[model samples]
Target: MHEINWLPFWLTIKLASITTFLLLLIGILLSYYLAYNRHKINTIIEALLSLPLVLPPTVLGFYLLILFNKQGLIGTLWYKIFNKQLVFHFEGLVVASVIYSLPMMVHPLTAGFRSVPKNLIEASFTLGKSRLETLIRVILPNMKASILTGIVLSFAHTVGEFGVAVMVGGNIEGETRVVSIAIYSAVESMDYKTAHIYALILFFMSFLTLLALYFLNKKWKPYDKA
Candidate 1:
């Protein structure tokens, strides 16, 4: 029984959870807007949302590294306001994770929103309901499973994130060292036992999370017969 460092594991979970929560909130709104709006700007927004899917993670991470550098536009402003750098910290990891997993969170949500029948949405609005009310009471309720699916996917993907964290976070122990990066370190140093343990843990956790999500969606979609 190799004594495991549970700190990195827990910190990774915390990072992933916070990242997923923020992505869920922002992704849902972004997806909704993209699904419902046909403005020319929406196309650009959608393209940016999907960029992570096509771009290599390392490239994305490198870009983020530059973007969050001390002299970068938002980075300099943020540093002056908060007296803190967004690079080489847990907060930086969160930002990288969010960007890396944005598509995972947004695509499913966009699909879910689009899946909602237009007639039902219109019917809700016909009853003197505002667009917001229609979204809250009708469209969203119908796509609960899809939203859940997106959240689960985002959390699972963020948990297993490696390149973005490493590139942006510097893999500092107890700071930005997430489980995936820790496992890589363990492997490189010939700490096979810990590496295997972490790998197995991540594999099983992701599998179980996805299984639960699918089963929950199955339970709901029985009444939503196509």
Candidate 2:
């Protein structure tokens, strides 16, 4: 058996965890707005947000690379403030993963928010609860399944990232080298055994994630009906 480098696996987990957390916050806010707002521009905003779902990872990564290059706007501003490069670092990987996995988080949450009964929200408002309060106490409680699904999907998507992670973070061992990059490296070096192991790990991880999501949704199904 080929000796597996576990560092990349751990790093991938850390990246996914952080990215999913951040995405949860951002996704919830965005989904809330998209659910409640009826402006024509919301369609445009949603389309922009969902672009990553259809866009090629390499294409997105290439643009991100340019945008975060030392000479680019974000990079220049970050350097001026922190005196550090953003690209080719773990931070960049997190940013890329968040952007890449945002649709997975937002889409599900948006649907969940929309699935919430309007009269229930109205009743909460009628009782003098603020929009934020209604969101927290009413909308969210009713959509626990969607929330779990979004979180799992975001984490799994981030863990499976390859092109964006590589393009934004590069292959810096013990730093930016995640499992997807490690698998690519193993394959490039014709190390089939290592590649197989990595592939199996990711496959099982993704499968289990989805399986757990479905199971949880099933368990929560009765609550949602109530």
Candidate 3:
């Protein structure tokens, strides 16, 4: 029997954490714009953003690989500035994760924003509050459930990412060897015991995450403290 290496699990958690944080920030701004604006172009933009949800992970990962390869445009610029390659690096994994998990975060935030009372937003504006202030003080406070849902979904999605992470970041140990990849490697090596253990852990983690989300949604009233 072989002792399990816990590094991959830690790496997966780190990736998920970073991905969720970036997606939250990006999701907020994008969701806010999409929620309030009415324009033909916005529809096109929304569709592009949502493509990840339906696109195959490998397809998205392949595009990212091309875009961030040593000779690729973005890759070249990053290499010139950072003096290192993006492919097969931890940073590349983060970028890939943000893109892959974007819709998970944005969809919920957009729904939350739209669910807010339009009159409440107008009143905040009429009271001389800035859009930013209104968003922080009013809109966000009322959209707790949506925000929570987005964060959880993005985190969970990033944790389970395999095809995209492998294609963009490769399975470099201690860099991009996330738990999902670890499980695959174990299976390939005929280490069924290790793979089973990893799979069980992931199953429990995902289950608990979703269970907590549902529980919180049931208990966390948006205006309870307001």
Candidate 4:
């Protein structure tokens, strides 16, 4: 019988949940700008936003580590304010996961916002609805599928995070040892059984998430057309 350690799995859930929640709010604002803004710098901003999608996790984590180090800008500021180190903490993991999974949230949301009919937006403005009101009442309601996809993708991506998590947060057992790092440590210790269990759980979770997204999109296609 393989003994499963639930701590890492639970911790992964906690991290993914918090990351996804924060990303949802940030993603909506950023995506709205990217989708509608015609500024020349929009292209450059979009490229930077999408960098994480292509960048290696370890590479991103390395830079984040520097940024969150005691001597680093963000770290120094945080230390001065909180008198606590940002590196190797759960809060650090949350920050790392947010940065690492941002594109997953932003891309789909931008597409969704762009897909909203321009006429409907204009009509909303004509009816005295502010940009924020139109965004809340018209745009988001029409892009349910895309919003759901972004949330699911962001959550799953955060759950599967390893390189960044390990780099920034380190393997501090219950503190920062999420499922990905747990699997890595298990394998390194030749505990194939434990590693397999962790790997299988993540595999199924990711697979199901994508599956749900596809199914929901299909179901919503007719409504979206109407």
For 192-220, candidate 3 gives per-residue lDDT tens digits of 99999999999999999999999998787
TM-score of each: 0.94, 0.95, 0.96, 0.96
Residue 202 alpha-carbon offset, candidate 1, angstroms? 0.8
State the lDDT of candidate 2 residue by residue for 5-96, as single tens digits.
Answer: 89998999999999999999999999999999999999999999999999999999999999888997888888899888889988888888
lDDT of each: 0.88, 0.91, 0.94, 0.92
| TM-score: the better of candidates 1 and 3 | 3
Off by over 4 Å in 1: 223-226
Q: Compared with the true structure, what per-residue lDDT tens digits does model 1 show for residues 59-139?
A: 999989998879877578769988999899888888889999999989988998999889988888778999889888888
Q: Which stretches of candidate 4 lie over 4 Å from their true place?
A: none
Q: Report how far off residue 179 is in candidate 1 (Å).
A: 0.5
RMSD score of candidate 2 (Å): 1.4
Worst 10 residues of 2 by lDDT: 1-10
- 1 versus 4: better lDDT goes to: 4
Pick the winner on TM-score between candidates 2 and 3. Answer: 3
Judging by lDDT against the true structure, name the best candidate: 3
